[model samples]
Target: MTATVHTLQANRAPSLEPMMALTTSGMNAVNAVILDRMQSKVALIPELAGHLIAGGGKRMRPMLTLASAALFDYPGTRHHKLAAAVEFIHTATLLHDDVVDGSGLRRGRRTANIIWGNPSSVLVGDFLFSRAFELMVEDGSLKVLKILSSASAIIAEGEVDQLTAQRRIDTDEDHYLQIIAAKTAALFAAACRIAPVVAEAGEEAEDALDTYGRNLGIAFQLVDDAIDYSSDSATMGKGVGDDFRDGKMTLPVILAYARGTDGDRDFWRSAISGDRVADEDLARAIDLVRSTGALADTLERARIYARRAVDSLGSFPAGKAKSAMIEAAEFAVARAY
Candidate 1:
């Protein structure tokens, strides 16, 4: 097996296509459920939710649900609805996050909050949460319910924790890691773990998948943080300096600030304190992250987590399912390029 941490040379990076191909039929089913469940008599509910749903977001979490079931060669369609539920939970978070962050762009388009206003965006997010729970209850598995519901709660707590830590120059890497594990990785873990439950593949399998998802989720977020400084909006699908402008204390910022000169530290403090948000300041911030090796180090850290994610699958049988999942982890870190 190829180690998941090799530097992704140009044109040799991993692709999500294999995973997408692996889960095609299942994803089609999941998509139908997503489209069907997002509907409501209230025109705005679907309208607002549909804006983000149709916004070219890669349904990665739900696809993980489908892919993990494939790992067991489970031949049931029950995962379709559950996968849809996972996506609903994810979409709900994105909606609420945009509102909370006052974000203007997502996936290269205006956010729902920007288009429809925060109140509608928030209420629609609440509606999606209701739909996610309804799907879970309809699944009729207490174990699945507990896993997803707990993840949802943890995600909420993580968001609150992030809100509290937002823009604080004193926020450390360990605290940042805890926040991402809950806010981001919790759903990823629940999405994969539920596969074994519906397949009745036992607790050991569940634990393995949980670890895979959690680590992959961390890698994914770390890459996103690095991309904010290194990639353009065309690549990132949002403003290149959005995190900087928002005063987000992502790993790249944390590391750069930690490794900065006295002058650089003062600049970071002012930048993160919202005192220096002009485009030139953003250019300087990007330079500091790169000059301090924070960007490269953050990506290396992502590769570390991605490797763990791939290793967690060692217990599973080897085949396209396992290979695709492994490549998915590679793709998570490779996206930075």
Candidate 2:
């Protein structure tokens, strides 16, 4: 049977706004720390960093860090520093991602690489990476240091794995999951996991939050992959079809290729593997993916993970933080709308 296609809908439920509101005070402190730490006498470091930081994308990762800490009633301000570190790592990855993807747009603005040049962007990314470590070291918690450092290594490994899998239509669903798990979910897991560490909330709470973050991260990336095909460049904050143009074999593409007819498979291989794809080719690829039900199935898979993310919070007592975190999972999938 052909793949099942379902109409997509926007999530009208309040998404991240509530979570942001819940953590507003803590996030303000985190933002202050971020602004203070991002400075430099070299001028370009702040210039480049601020270019992306001020571009208006939601600081979801750092928000997760703060909210997770609040979930456990963390007493110290250490999480503020950790939240800043998380943001730095996330922002650094974005800069490098823009360069790697040869992307020209992010958050509806010119990419840092496009305005500042690739070398500058890459070097500044390295600067941010080093700064993240500096912040970690300043916190002076060995456990915290270990958690974030390991996540950084995993994120780098995930990027390399994705590089290896690129343009290879033979890449499967399992491999796609592995790549995103490391690249995207690792940070989310680390950010949440660190909250419990700082609060001395014990291993049980830490594990639950880690599970929550990992599942939410997977769901988040799934929707992001789907949006790349379905949304406009302006709405998505990045080039539409950038993944398709780069031959990145995300879950939707993998599912479509597997479910497609022989001719459909051939078209996917040619469209993705070629040196250059015309606009018409991307249009046809989107149509093929939709008809094969890849988008709907991929999103359905995301919803499952989102539910798992929400379920992970069941162990926590009923509270605003727990509720917000649950909505955060829903937001991850709902963002596709």
Distance from true location, Cα of 160 in model 1, Å: 0.6
- Give the TM-score comparing model 2 with the true structure, all chains together: 0.95
Give the clashing residue pairs of candidate 1, or none. Answer: none
Per-candidate TM-scores read: 0.96, 0.95
Q: Give the number of the best model, judged by lDDT.
A: 1
- List pairs with backbone clashes in candidate 2: none
Candidate 1 stretches greater than 4 Å from native: 1-11
Error in Å for residue 292 of model 2: 1.0
- Candidate 1 accuracy as lDDT: 0.92
Give each model's clash number: 0, 0
Q: Candidates' lDDT values, in order? A: 0.92, 0.89
Task: Give lDDT tens digits, candidate 1, residues 245-295.
Answer: 999999999999999999999999999989999989999999999999999
